[model samples]
Target: MDTIAVDPDLYAAQSAYAPDDWQSETTSIRSSIYRGLMDNGRRIPSDEQQFETYEAGHLVDLILDSDRDNPLFRSPIGADRERPLQVLDIGTGKGTWAIDVADMFPNATVRGVDLFPPPVTWMPPNCVIEVDDVLQDWTWRERFDLIHMRNMIGSFDNAEWDRVYEQCFEKMAPGGWIEQLEVGPFITSDDNSLPEDSALASWGPILQKCGDRAGRPCDIVLTMPQSIKNAGFVDVHEKVYKWPIGPWPRDQKFKEAGMVNSQHWMSGMEGWCMWLLTKYGDPEPWTKDEVHVFCAKLRNELKNPHYHAYHKA
Candidate 1:
Protein backbone atom coordinates (compact mmCIF):
# COMPACT_ATOMS: atom_id res chain seq x y z
CA MET A 1 0.00 0.00 0.00
CA ASP A 2 1.21 3.51 -0.70
CA THR A 3 2.01 5.40 2.50
CA ILE A 4 0.55 8.75 3.37
CA ALA A 5 3.12 11.48 3.61
CA VAL A 6 3.57 13.01 7.05
CA ASP A 7 3.43 16.80 6.89
CA PRO A 8 6.69 17.54 8.66
CA ASP A 9 5.91 21.26 8.76
CA LEU A 10 2.66 20.72 10.67
CA TYR A 11 4.33 17.96 12.64
CA ALA A 12 6.96 20.45 13.83
CA ALA A 13 4.30 22.85 15.02
CA GLN A 14 2.27 20.02 16.55
CA SER A 15 5.26 18.69 18.48
CA ALA A 16 5.76 22.03 20.18
CA TYR A 17 2.18 22.61 21.47
CA ALA A 18 0.43 19.29 20.86
CA PRO A 19 1.30 15.64 21.23
CA ASP A 20 2.75 13.74 18.27
CA ASP A 21 -0.60 12.00 17.92
CA TRP A 22 -2.58 15.19 18.30
CA GLN A 23 -3.89 15.26 14.79
CA SER A 24 -4.60 11.52 14.60
CA GLU A 25 -8.10 12.28 13.32
CA THR A 26 -7.45 15.32 11.16
CA THR A 27 -9.44 16.80 8.32
CA SER A 28 -7.96 16.62 4.85
CA ILE A 29 -8.90 19.37 2.40
CA ARG A 30 -5.51 19.85 0.77
CA SER A 31 -4.41 20.29 4.41
CA SER A 32 -6.36 23.52 4.56
CA ILE A 33 -7.53 23.00 8.18
CA TYR A 34 -7.61 20.60 11.14
CA ARG A 35 -10.33 19.25 13.48
CA GLY A 36 -8.47 17.79 16.43
CA LEU A 37 -9.29 20.25 19.19
CA MET A 38 -12.36 22.10 18.05
CA ASP A 39 -15.35 21.86 15.74
CA ASN A 40 -13.48 23.99 13.23
CA GLY A 41 -9.78 23.59 12.58
CA ARG A 42 -9.13 27.21 13.46
CA ARG A 43 -9.95 26.56 17.11
CA ILE A 44 -7.29 23.87 17.52
CA PRO A 45 -5.02 26.02 19.69
CA SER A 46 -6.89 28.17 22.18
CA ASP A 47 -4.87 27.67 25.34
CA GLU A 48 -1.60 29.31 24.32
CA GLN A 49 -2.41 31.26 21.18
CA GLN A 50 -5.46 32.86 22.82
CA PHE A 51 -8.10 30.80 21.06
CA GLU A 52 -10.76 32.24 23.38
CA THR A 53 -12.34 33.43 20.18
CA TYR A 54 -12.81 30.54 17.81
CA GLU A 55 -11.01 31.00 14.50
CA ALA A 56 -8.25 33.21 15.80
CA GLY A 57 -8.30 36.41 13.80
CA HIS A 58 -7.89 38.09 17.16
CA LEU A 59 -4.19 37.44 16.90
CA VAL A 60 -4.29 38.77 13.35
CA ASP A 61 -5.95 41.93 14.60
CA LEU A 62 -3.30 42.45 17.25
CA ILE A 63 -0.68 42.83 14.54
CA LEU A 64 -3.00 44.63 12.14
CA ASP A 65 -3.62 47.44 14.63
CA SER A 66 -2.11 46.29 17.94
CA ASP A 67 -5.61 45.06 18.89
CA ARG A 68 -6.84 48.64 18.73
CA ASP A 69 -10.42 49.77 18.27
CA ASN A 70 -10.06 50.27 14.58
CA PRO A 71 -13.17 49.41 12.63
CA LEU A 72 -13.43 45.80 11.40
CA PHE A 73 -13.31 47.35 7.93
CA ARG A 74 -12.26 50.77 6.79
CA SER A 75 -15.12 51.06 4.29
CA PRO A 76 -17.47 53.85 5.36
CA ILE A 77 -20.75 52.39 4.23
CA GLY A 78 -22.84 54.14 6.88
CA ALA A 79 -23.98 50.83 8.34
CA ASP A 80 -26.50 51.49 11.07
CA ARG A 81 -29.77 50.29 12.56
CA GLU A 82 -31.79 52.61 10.36
CA ARG A 83 -30.29 51.67 6.97
CA PRO A 84 -29.44 48.01 6.63
CA LEU A 85 -26.07 47.73 4.87
CA GLN A 86 -24.91 44.98 2.56
CA VAL A 87 -21.35 43.76 3.10
CA LEU A 88 -19.41 41.08 1.28
CA ASP A 89 -16.12 39.37 2.08
CA ILE A 90 -14.49 37.51 -0.77
CA GLY A 91 -12.06 34.72 0.11
CA THR A 92 -13.24 34.76 3.69
CA GLY A 93 -10.83 32.19 5.07
CA LYS A 94 -12.31 30.62 8.22
CA GLY A 95 -14.98 33.38 8.06
CA THR A 96 -13.56 35.14 11.12
CA TRP A 97 -13.45 38.60 9.57
CA ALA A 98 -16.93 38.22 8.19
CA ILE A 99 -18.31 36.98 11.49
CA ASP A 100 -16.66 39.84 13.33
CA VAL A 101 -18.12 42.33 10.92
CA ALA A 102 -21.54 40.74 11.26
CA ASP A 103 -21.35 40.96 15.03
CA MET A 104 -20.10 44.54 14.83
CA PHE A 105 -23.05 45.82 12.86
CA PRO A 106 -26.16 43.71 13.39
CA ASN A 107 -28.01 45.98 11.02
CA ALA A 108 -25.65 45.08 8.20
CA THR A 109 -26.05 41.74 6.46
CA VAL A 110 -22.56 40.32 5.88
CA ARG A 111 -21.96 37.69 3.22
CA GLY A 112 -18.67 35.78 2.96
CA VAL A 113 -17.88 33.77 -0.15
CA ASP A 114 -14.98 31.35 -0.60
CA LEU A 115 -14.08 28.52 -2.91
CA PHE A 116 -14.00 26.17 0.09
CA PRO A 117 -16.72 26.16 2.68
CA PRO A 118 -15.47 26.76 6.20
CA PRO A 119 -15.91 23.95 8.76
CA VAL A 120 -17.85 26.51 10.74
CA THR A 121 -20.84 24.97 12.52
CA TRP A 122 -22.37 28.18 13.81
CA MET A 123 -22.80 31.66 12.42
CA PRO A 124 -24.35 35.00 13.31
CA PRO A 125 -27.96 35.39 12.26
CA ASN A 126 -27.05 38.16 9.91
CA CYS A 127 -23.85 36.53 8.57
CA VAL A 128 -23.82 34.06 5.71
CA ILE A 129 -20.83 31.97 4.61
CA GLU A 130 -21.24 30.45 1.19
CA VAL A 131 -19.05 28.33 -1.03
CA ASP A 132 -18.67 29.83 -4.49
CA ASP A 133 -16.01 30.57 -7.05
CA VAL A 134 -15.76 34.32 -7.51
CA LEU A 135 -14.34 33.96 -11.02
CA GLN A 136 -17.77 32.80 -12.15
CA ASP A 137 -20.78 35.03 -12.46
CA TRP A 138 -21.99 36.31 -9.09
CA THR A 139 -25.45 35.26 -7.89
CA TRP A 140 -25.84 37.99 -5.29
CA ARG A 141 -29.06 39.85 -6.00
CA GLU A 142 -28.42 42.93 -3.86
CA ARG A 143 -25.57 45.37 -4.56
CA PHE A 144 -23.01 45.58 -1.78
CA ASP A 145 -22.17 48.58 0.39
CA LEU A 146 -18.69 47.18 1.07
CA ILE A 147 -16.78 44.42 -0.66
CA HIS A 148 -13.65 43.16 1.08
CA MET A 149 -10.89 40.61 0.54
CA ARG A 150 -7.58 39.92 2.26
CA ASN A 151 -4.79 37.35 2.31
CA MET A 152 -5.91 36.44 -1.20
CA ILE A 153 -2.55 36.71 -2.91
CA GLY A 154 -1.75 33.99 -5.39
CA SER A 155 -5.36 32.78 -5.24
CA PHE A 156 -6.06 34.01 -8.76
CA ASP A 157 -4.35 34.34 -12.08
CA ASN A 158 -4.07 37.82 -13.65
CA ALA A 159 -7.11 37.35 -15.83
CA GLU A 160 -9.07 35.84 -12.99
CA TRP A 161 -8.16 38.76 -10.75
CA ASP A 162 -9.27 41.20 -13.43
CA ARG A 163 -12.55 39.35 -13.81
CA VAL A 164 -13.12 39.16 -10.05
CA TYR A 165 -12.50 42.90 -9.68
CA GLU A 166 -14.78 43.64 -12.61
CA GLN A 167 -17.48 41.59 -10.91
CA CYS A 168 -16.90 43.53 -7.72
CA PHE A 169 -17.32 46.77 -9.65
CA GLU A 170 -20.49 45.51 -11.28
CA LYS A 171 -22.05 44.14 -8.07
CA MET A 172 -21.32 47.03 -5.75
CA ALA A 173 -23.83 49.84 -5.14
CA PRO A 174 -22.99 53.39 -6.03
CA GLY A 175 -20.50 54.92 -3.58
CA GLY A 176 -19.79 51.48 -2.12
CA TRP A 177 -16.20 50.92 -1.04
CA ILE A 178 -14.05 47.97 -1.99
CA GLU A 179 -11.22 46.99 0.35
CA GLN A 180 -8.47 44.41 -0.01
CA LEU A 181 -5.30 43.54 1.88
CA GLU A 182 -2.53 41.20 0.78
CA VAL A 183 0.71 40.25 2.51
CA GLY A 184 4.12 40.00 0.89
CA PRO A 185 5.54 36.47 0.93
CA PHE A 186 9.10 37.71 1.32
CA ILE A 187 10.69 38.08 4.73
CA THR A 188 12.84 41.20 5.12
CA SER A 189 15.32 42.48 7.68
CA ASP A 190 16.24 46.12 8.18
CA ASP A 191 19.58 45.34 9.90
CA ASN A 192 20.58 42.18 8.00
CA SER A 193 19.54 39.96 10.88
CA LEU A 194 18.25 37.40 8.37
CA PRO A 195 21.24 36.01 6.52
CA GLU A 196 21.44 36.15 2.73
CA ASP A 197 22.04 32.39 2.30
CA SER A 198 19.34 31.36 4.77
CA ALA A 199 16.13 29.55 3.85
CA LEU A 200 14.18 32.51 5.24
CA ALA A 201 15.76 34.74 2.62
CA SER A 202 15.22 32.31 -0.25
CA TRP A 203 11.58 31.45 0.48
CA GLY A 204 10.06 34.47 -1.22
CA PRO A 205 11.92 34.14 -4.52
CA ILE A 206 11.40 30.38 -4.56
CA LEU A 207 7.63 30.65 -4.16
CA GLN A 208 7.45 33.71 -6.39
CA LYS A 209 8.90 31.63 -9.20
CA CYS A 210 6.60 28.73 -8.40
CA GLY A 211 3.57 31.00 -8.22
CA ASP A 212 4.51 32.55 -11.55
CA ARG A 213 4.70 29.11 -13.13
CA ALA A 214 1.32 28.31 -11.56
CA GLY A 215 -0.07 31.45 -13.24
CA ARG A 216 -1.00 32.91 -9.87
CA PRO A 217 1.71 35.39 -8.96
CA CYS A 218 2.45 35.80 -5.23
CA ASP A 219 3.59 39.42 -5.59
CA ILE A 220 0.01 40.64 -5.37
CA VAL A 221 0.70 43.21 -2.66
CA LEU A 222 2.98 45.25 -4.88
CA THR A 223 0.75 45.24 -7.95
CA MET A 224 -2.76 45.44 -6.44
CA PRO A 225 -2.99 49.23 -6.25
CA GLN A 226 -2.51 49.58 -9.97
CA SER A 227 -4.75 46.60 -10.60
CA ILE A 228 -7.52 48.05 -8.45
CA LYS A 229 -7.29 51.35 -10.32
CA ASN A 230 -7.33 49.50 -13.62
CA ALA A 231 -10.55 47.80 -12.51
CA GLY A 232 -12.19 51.26 -12.52
CA PHE A 233 -11.88 52.00 -8.81
CA VAL A 234 -10.75 55.53 -7.95
CA ASP A 235 -9.27 57.32 -4.92
CA VAL A 236 -7.62 54.16 -3.60
CA HIS A 237 -6.07 54.45 -0.16
CA GLU A 238 -3.04 52.35 0.68
CA LYS A 239 -1.62 51.21 4.01
CA VAL A 240 1.55 49.16 4.37
CA TYR A 241 2.61 47.33 7.52
CA LYS A 242 5.71 45.61 8.79
CA TRP A 243 4.38 42.52 10.56
CA PRO A 244 7.17 40.93 12.59
CA ILE A 245 7.32 37.14 12.37
CA GLY A 246 8.63 36.60 15.90
CA PRO A 247 8.73 38.31 19.25
CA TRP A 248 12.06 40.01 18.66
CA PRO A 249 10.96 43.61 18.47
CA ARG A 250 12.02 45.99 21.25
CA ASP A 251 8.70 47.76 21.39
CA GLN A 252 6.05 46.14 23.59
CA LYS A 253 3.27 46.30 20.99
CA PHE A 254 5.38 44.80 18.20
CA LYS A 255 6.79 42.18 20.54
CA GLU A 256 3.30 40.97 21.47
CA ALA A 257 2.15 41.20 17.89
CA GLY A 258 5.20 39.27 16.75
CA MET A 259 4.60 36.51 19.26
CA VAL A 260 1.05 36.00 18.01
CA ASN A 261 2.10 36.36 14.39
CA SER A 262 4.71 33.63 14.84
CA GLN A 263 1.94 31.14 15.58
CA HIS A 264 0.24 32.44 12.45
CA TRP A 265 3.29 31.48 10.41
CA MET A 266 4.09 28.18 12.11
CA SER A 267 0.56 26.99 11.54
CA GLY A 268 -0.01 28.54 8.12
CA MET A 269 3.24 28.36 6.08
CA GLU A 270 3.06 24.79 4.80
CA GLY A 271 -0.57 25.03 3.69
CA TRP A 272 0.23 28.26 1.89
CA CYS A 273 3.06 26.67 -0.12
CA MET A 274 2.10 23.01 -0.52
CA TRP A 275 0.00 23.26 -3.69
CA LEU A 276 2.25 25.76 -5.41
CA LEU A 277 5.50 23.89 -4.77
CA THR A 278 4.12 20.44 -5.44
CA LYS A 279 2.66 21.59 -8.74
CA TYR A 280 5.17 24.19 -9.93
CA GLY A 281 8.41 23.74 -8.02
CA ASP A 282 11.48 25.00 -9.75
CA PRO A 283 13.41 22.62 -12.09
CA GLU A 284 10.76 20.05 -11.21
CA PRO A 285 7.66 19.60 -9.11
CA TRP A 286 8.78 18.85 -5.57
CA THR A 287 7.89 15.74 -3.67
CA LYS A 288 6.11 16.26 -0.37
CA ASP A 289 9.28 15.16 1.45
CA GLU A 290 11.36 17.83 -0.25
CA VAL A 291 8.91 20.54 0.74
CA HIS A 292 8.94 19.14 4.27
CA VAL A 293 12.71 19.52 4.50
CA PHE A 294 12.50 23.09 3.23
CA CYS A 295 9.79 23.92 5.77
CA ALA A 296 11.84 22.36 8.58
CA LYS A 297 14.77 24.64 7.76
CA LEU A 298 12.47 27.65 7.60
CA ARG A 299 10.87 26.72 10.94
CA ASN A 300 14.28 26.63 12.58
CA GLU A 301 15.26 29.97 11.06
CA LEU A 302 11.96 31.56 12.10
CA LYS A 303 12.47 30.46 15.70
CA ASN A 304 15.82 32.23 15.90
CA PRO A 305 15.65 35.19 18.29
CA HIS A 306 18.20 37.34 16.52
CA TYR A 307 16.40 37.41 13.18
CA HIS A 308 14.26 40.54 12.87
CA ALA A 309 12.35 39.46 9.76
CA TYR A 310 9.05 41.13 9.05
CA HIS A 311 6.59 40.38 6.24
CA LYS A 312 5.04 43.28 4.38
CA ALA A 313 1.31 43.31 5.26
Candidate 2:
Protein backbone atom coordinates (compact mmCIF):
# COMPACT_ATOMS: atom_id res chain seq x y z
CA MET A 1 0.00 0.00 0.00
CA ASP A 2 2.92 2.35 -0.56
CA THR A 3 1.86 5.16 -2.88
CA ILE A 4 4.84 5.89 -5.11
CA ALA A 5 5.17 9.45 -6.29
CA VAL A 6 7.29 9.94 -9.36
CA ASP A 7 7.87 12.92 -11.61
CA PRO A 8 4.59 13.66 -13.39
CA ASP A 9 5.92 12.62 -16.75
CA LEU A 10 7.52 9.45 -15.44
CA TYR A 11 4.42 8.51 -13.50
CA ALA A 12 2.22 9.10 -16.52
CA ALA A 13 4.46 6.96 -18.69
CA GLN A 14 4.48 4.06 -16.25
CA SER A 15 0.74 4.30 -15.65
CA ALA A 16 0.21 2.95 -19.13
CA TYR A 17 0.92 -0.54 -17.91
CA ALA A 18 -2.26 -2.56 -17.78
CA PRO A 19 -3.09 -4.11 -14.41
CA ASP A 20 -1.39 -7.19 -15.73
CA ASP A 21 1.76 -5.52 -17.06
CA TRP A 22 3.51 -4.58 -13.80
CA GLN A 23 5.99 -7.37 -13.14
CA SER A 24 6.92 -6.91 -9.52
CA GLU A 25 4.39 -7.85 -6.83
CA THR A 26 4.15 -7.19 -3.13
CA THR A 27 4.73 -10.30 -1.03
CA SER A 28 1.77 -9.47 1.22
CA ILE A 29 -1.70 -8.80 -0.13
CA ARG A 30 -4.22 -7.02 2.11
CA SER A 31 -7.27 -7.73 -0.01
CA SER A 32 -8.37 -10.45 2.36
CA ILE A 33 -8.20 -8.08 5.27
CA TYR A 34 -10.24 -5.64 3.29
CA ARG A 35 -12.75 -8.38 2.67
CA GLY A 36 -12.76 -9.43 6.29
CA LEU A 37 -13.36 -5.90 7.42
CA MET A 38 -16.13 -5.50 4.93
CA ASP A 39 -17.71 -8.81 5.91
CA ASN A 40 -17.61 -7.87 9.57
CA GLY A 41 -19.17 -4.48 8.75
CA ARG A 42 -16.00 -2.65 9.71
CA ARG A 43 -14.04 -0.20 7.68
CA ILE A 44 -10.70 -1.37 6.39
CA PRO A 45 -7.81 0.70 7.57
CA SER A 46 -5.70 2.52 5.08
CA ASP A 47 -2.03 1.85 4.40
CA GLU A 48 -1.37 3.60 7.68
CA GLN A 49 -3.55 1.16 9.56
CA GLN A 50 -1.86 -1.84 7.99
CA PHE A 51 1.56 -0.43 8.82
CA GLU A 52 0.62 0.30 12.42
CA THR A 53 -0.87 -3.15 12.84
CA TYR A 54 2.39 -4.77 11.81
CA GLU A 55 4.60 -2.35 13.72
CA ALA A 56 2.63 -2.85 16.92
CA GLY A 57 3.98 -6.38 17.05
CA HIS A 58 6.61 -7.20 19.67
CA LEU A 59 8.90 -8.75 17.05
CA VAL A 60 9.95 -5.31 15.81
CA ASP A 61 10.52 -4.13 19.38
CA LEU A 62 12.76 -7.11 20.04
CA ILE A 63 14.75 -6.41 16.89
CA LEU A 64 15.28 -2.80 17.91
CA ASP A 65 16.26 -3.79 21.43
CA SER A 66 18.79 -6.29 20.13
CA ASP A 67 20.29 -3.71 17.81
CA ARG A 68 20.47 -1.05 20.50
CA ASP A 69 22.19 -3.51 22.83
CA ASN A 70 24.56 -4.79 20.15
CA PRO A 71 28.21 -3.91 20.72
CA LEU A 72 28.43 -1.96 17.46
CA PHE A 73 25.63 0.43 18.44
CA ARG A 74 26.95 0.77 22.01
CA SER A 75 30.15 2.47 20.80
CA PRO A 76 30.26 6.04 22.08
CA ILE A 77 29.97 8.96 19.70
CA GLY A 78 32.12 11.16 21.93
CA ALA A 79 30.81 14.24 23.80
CA ASP A 80 30.11 16.26 20.67
CA ARG A 81 26.64 17.70 21.25
CA GLU A 82 27.02 20.52 18.70
CA ARG A 83 26.46 18.09 15.82
CA PRO A 84 23.69 15.53 16.13
CA LEU A 85 24.28 11.96 14.93
CA GLN A 86 22.38 11.02 11.73
CA VAL A 87 20.74 7.68 10.90
CA LEU A 88 18.95 6.58 7.72
CA ASP A 89 16.37 3.82 7.34
CA ILE A 90 16.10 2.73 3.73
CA GLY A 91 12.76 1.37 2.47
CA THR A 92 11.28 2.45 5.74
CA GLY A 93 7.58 1.65 5.41
CA LYS A 94 6.12 2.67 8.77
CA GLY A 95 9.16 4.60 10.07
CA THR A 96 9.07 2.34 13.12
CA TRP A 97 12.85 2.14 13.39
CA ALA A 98 13.27 5.87 12.97
CA ILE A 99 10.70 6.56 15.67
CA ASP A 100 12.07 3.90 18.03
CA VAL A 101 15.69 4.87 17.52
CA ALA A 102 14.97 8.57 17.95
CA ASP A 103 13.19 7.82 21.23
CA MET A 104 16.02 5.52 22.31
CA PHE A 105 18.77 8.03 21.45
CA PRO A 106 17.42 11.50 22.05
CA ASN A 107 20.61 13.08 20.65
CA ALA A 108 20.37 11.35 17.29
CA THR A 109 18.43 12.46 14.17
CA VAL A 110 16.81 9.82 12.02
CA ARG A 111 15.51 9.82 8.44
CA GLY A 112 13.38 7.21 6.68
CA VAL A 113 13.41 6.93 2.88
CA ASP A 114 11.11 4.91 0.69
CA LEU A 115 9.78 4.75 -2.87
CA PHE A 116 6.25 5.19 -1.61
CA PRO A 117 4.76 7.82 0.64
CA PRO A 118 5.38 6.76 4.25
CA PRO A 119 2.16 5.27 5.56
CA VAL A 120 2.69 6.37 9.18
CA THR A 121 3.01 9.89 10.58
CA TRP A 122 4.80 11.32 13.60
CA MET A 123 6.03 14.78 14.62
CA PRO A 124 9.08 13.73 16.61
CA PRO A 125 11.50 16.65 16.29
CA ASN A 126 14.37 14.25 15.67
CA CYS A 127 12.81 12.20 12.86
CA VAL A 128 12.08 12.98 9.17
CA ILE A 129 11.01 11.06 6.08
CA GLU A 130 11.69 11.41 2.35
CA VAL A 131 9.58 9.95 -0.45
CA ASP A 132 11.81 8.52 -3.13
CA ASP A 133 13.27 5.26 -4.37
CA VAL A 134 16.67 4.57 -2.79
CA LEU A 135 17.80 2.69 -5.89
CA GLN A 136 17.76 5.84 -7.95
CA ASP A 137 20.74 8.18 -8.17
CA TRP A 138 20.64 10.68 -5.32
CA THR A 139 22.90 13.37 -3.94
CA TRP A 140 23.12 13.86 -0.17
CA ARG A 141 25.22 16.70 1.17
CA GLU A 142 25.44 15.09 4.63
CA ARG A 143 26.88 11.84 5.94
CA PHE A 144 25.18 9.53 8.44
CA ASP A 145 26.35 7.67 11.56
CA LEU A 146 24.10 4.68 10.79
CA ILE A 147 22.38 3.29 7.69
CA HIS A 148 19.70 0.59 7.96
CA MET A 149 17.96 -1.33 5.17
CA ARG A 150 15.34 -3.95 5.95
CA ASN A 151 13.22 -6.29 3.81
CA MET A 152 14.23 -4.78 0.46
CA ILE A 153 14.78 -8.08 -1.34
CA GLY A 154 11.45 -8.14 -3.15
CA SER A 155 11.81 -4.57 -4.30
CA PHE A 156 15.40 -4.24 -5.53
CA ASP A 157 17.57 -6.34 -7.78
CA ASN A 158 20.94 -7.68 -6.67
CA ALA A 159 22.83 -5.20 -8.85
CA GLU A 160 20.67 -2.40 -7.52
CA TRP A 161 21.43 -3.49 -3.96
CA ASP A 162 25.16 -3.37 -4.63
CA ARG A 163 24.73 0.16 -5.89
CA VAL A 164 22.64 1.08 -2.83
CA TYR A 165 25.30 -0.24 -0.45
CA GLU A 166 27.97 1.69 -2.34
CA GLN A 167 25.95 4.85 -1.90
CA CYS A 168 25.42 4.03 1.79
CA PHE A 169 29.15 3.56 2.25
CA GLU A 170 29.81 6.93 0.66
CA LYS A 171 27.24 8.57 2.91
CA MET A 172 28.39 6.89 6.13
CA ALA A 173 30.70 8.80 8.47
CA PRO A 174 33.93 7.27 9.66
CA GLY A 175 33.28 4.54 12.28
CA GLY A 176 29.66 4.48 11.21
CA TRP A 177 27.46 1.37 11.18
CA ILE A 178 25.39 -0.03 8.32
CA GLU A 179 22.87 -2.74 9.14
CA GLN A 180 20.98 -4.77 6.56
CA LEU A 181 18.11 -7.01 7.72
CA GLU A 182 16.94 -9.57 5.23
CA VAL A 183 15.39 -13.06 5.29
CA GLY A 184 15.93 -16.07 3.08
CA PRO A 185 12.60 -16.86 1.39
CA PHE A 186 13.48 -20.49 1.80
CA ILE A 187 11.88 -21.43 5.14
CA THR A 188 13.05 -23.89 7.77
CA SER A 189 11.90 -25.03 11.23
CA ASP A 190 13.22 -27.40 13.92
CA ASP A 191 9.63 -28.58 14.41
CA ASN A 192 9.41 -30.06 10.90
CA SER A 193 6.04 -28.40 10.36
CA LEU A 194 6.56 -27.03 6.84
CA PRO A 195 5.91 -29.44 4.01
CA GLU A 196 8.38 -29.71 1.14
CA ASP A 197 5.94 -28.17 -1.34
CA SER A 198 5.03 -25.25 0.89
CA ALA A 199 5.32 -21.70 -0.40
CA LEU A 200 8.18 -21.18 2.01
CA ALA A 201 10.10 -23.73 -0.01
CA SER A 202 8.71 -22.64 -3.38
CA TRP A 203 8.74 -18.86 -2.90
CA GLY A 204 12.44 -18.51 -3.62
CA PRO A 205 12.28 -20.41 -6.90
CA ILE A 206 9.04 -18.78 -8.03
CA LEU A 207 10.24 -15.32 -7.13
CA GLN A 208 13.60 -15.96 -8.77
CA LYS A 209 11.90 -17.15 -11.92
CA CYS A 210 9.57 -14.17 -11.95
CA GLY A 211 12.49 -11.82 -11.41
CA ASP A 212 14.52 -13.50 -14.12
CA ARG A 213 11.70 -13.14 -16.57
CA ALA A 214 11.45 -9.49 -15.59
CA GLY A 215 15.22 -9.08 -16.16
CA ARG A 216 15.71 -8.04 -12.53
CA PRO A 217 16.65 -10.65 -9.98
CA CYS A 218 14.91 -9.59 -6.75
CA ASP A 219 16.20 -12.41 -4.55
CA ILE A 220 18.90 -10.70 -2.44
CA VAL A 221 18.06 -12.17 0.97
CA LEU A 222 20.78 -14.83 0.89
CA THR A 223 23.52 -12.53 -0.42
CA MET A 224 23.02 -9.32 1.60
CA PRO A 225 25.68 -10.00 4.27
CA GLN A 226 28.50 -10.48 1.79
CA SER A 227 27.15 -7.57 -0.22
CA ILE A 228 27.34 -5.26 2.82
CA LYS A 229 30.82 -6.44 3.85
CA ASN A 230 31.95 -5.89 0.25
CA ALA A 231 30.79 -2.29 0.58
CA GLY A 232 33.54 -1.74 3.20
CA PHE A 233 31.81 -1.73 6.59
CA VAL A 234 33.90 -2.79 9.61
CA ASP A 235 33.02 -4.72 12.77
CA VAL A 236 29.94 -6.15 11.09
CA HIS A 237 27.41 -8.18 13.09
CA GLU A 238 24.44 -10.35 12.10
CA LYS A 239 21.39 -11.52 14.07
CA VAL A 240 18.46 -13.72 13.09
CA TYR A 241 14.87 -13.85 14.37
CA LYS A 242 12.21 -16.45 13.80
CA TRP A 243 8.79 -14.94 12.94
CA PRO A 244 5.82 -17.18 13.47
CA ILE A 245 2.98 -16.77 11.00
CA GLY A 246 -0.03 -17.80 13.05
CA PRO A 247 -1.35 -18.75 16.50
CA TRP A 248 0.45 -22.07 16.61
CA PRO A 249 3.28 -20.72 18.72
CA ARG A 250 3.74 -21.66 22.37
CA ASP A 251 4.74 -18.14 23.31
CA GLN A 252 1.69 -15.89 23.67
CA LYS A 253 3.28 -12.76 22.22
CA PHE A 254 4.81 -14.62 19.31
CA LYS A 255 1.54 -16.39 18.69
CA GLU A 256 -0.35 -13.13 18.50
CA ALA A 257 2.14 -11.55 16.10
CA GLY A 258 2.25 -14.70 14.02
CA MET A 259 -1.52 -14.74 13.68
CA VAL A 260 -1.52 -11.14 12.55
CA ASN A 261 1.35 -11.61 10.10
CA SER A 262 -0.21 -14.77 8.74
CA GLN A 263 -3.56 -13.11 8.24
CA HIS A 264 -1.92 -10.16 6.50
CA TRP A 265 0.41 -12.22 4.34
CA MET A 266 -2.06 -14.91 3.34
CA SER A 267 -4.75 -12.44 2.37
CA GLY A 268 -2.21 -10.61 0.28
CA MET A 269 -0.65 -13.61 -1.43
CA GLU A 270 -2.99 -13.66 -4.42
CA GLY A 271 -2.34 -10.09 -5.37
CA TRP A 272 1.36 -10.84 -5.11
CA CYS A 273 1.12 -13.94 -7.29
CA MET A 274 -1.37 -12.42 -9.70
CA TRP A 275 0.88 -9.49 -10.44
CA LEU A 276 3.32 -12.03 -11.83
CA LEU A 277 0.90 -14.43 -13.47
CA THR A 278 -1.04 -11.66 -15.11
CA LYS A 279 2.25 -10.26 -16.39
CA TYR A 280 3.81 -13.51 -17.63
CA GLY A 281 0.55 -14.93 -19.01
CA ASP A 282 1.01 -17.82 -16.57
CA PRO A 283 -2.30 -17.74 -14.76
CA GLU A 284 -3.25 -20.95 -16.47
CA PRO A 285 -1.25 -22.98 -13.99
CA TRP A 286 -2.67 -21.18 -10.95
CA THR A 287 -6.35 -20.49 -11.27
CA LYS A 288 -8.03 -18.09 -8.89
CA ASP A 289 -9.44 -20.99 -6.88
CA GLU A 290 -6.07 -22.68 -6.54
CA VAL A 291 -4.48 -19.44 -5.43
CA HIS A 292 -7.05 -18.95 -2.67
CA VAL A 293 -6.62 -22.49 -1.43
CA PHE A 294 -2.84 -22.16 -1.44
CA CYS A 295 -3.00 -19.01 0.66
CA ALA A 296 -5.24 -20.77 3.19
CA LYS A 297 -2.81 -23.66 3.37
CA LEU A 298 0.11 -21.31 3.80
CA ARG A 299 -1.73 -19.49 6.54
CA ASN A 300 -2.32 -22.77 8.34
CA GLU A 301 1.38 -23.59 8.11
CA LEU A 302 2.32 -20.30 9.81
CA LYS A 303 1.74 -22.10 13.12
CA ASN A 304 5.42 -23.09 13.07
CA PRO A 305 7.77 -20.19 13.83
CA HIS A 306 10.89 -19.92 11.70
CA TYR A 307 12.93 -17.29 9.82
CA HIS A 308 16.57 -16.52 8.92
CA ALA A 309 18.76 -13.46 9.29
CA TYR A 310 21.22 -11.40 7.27
CA HIS A 311 21.85 -8.46 9.60
CA LYS A 312 25.33 -7.06 9.00
CA ALA A 313 27.55 -4.20 7.87
> Which candidate comes out best when scored by lDDT?
1
Report the Cα lDDT for candidate 1. 0.72
User: Considering only N, C-alpha and C atoms within 3 Å, which residue pairs clash in candidate 2?
Assistant: 29-268, 178-313, 245-258
lDDT of 1 at 153: 82
State, as a TM-score between 0 and 1, how close model 1 is to the true structure. Answer: 0.81
List, residue by residue over 44-119, the lDDT tens digit for candidate 1: 5334321232243344453457344544666666545678899999988678778867876888899999888776
Residue 181 in candidate 2, Cα distance off native in Å: 0.9
The per-residue C-alpha lDDT of model 2 at residue 7 equals 24
lDDT of 2: 0.54
- How close is every model to the real structure, measured as TM-score? 0.81, 0.67
Angstrom error at residue 168, model 1:
0.2
Task: Give the per-residue lDDT of model 2 (tens digit) for 156-267.
Answer: 6567778999999989888787876654454444445455677565655675677667655545655676888888876766665565444344444443344444444544
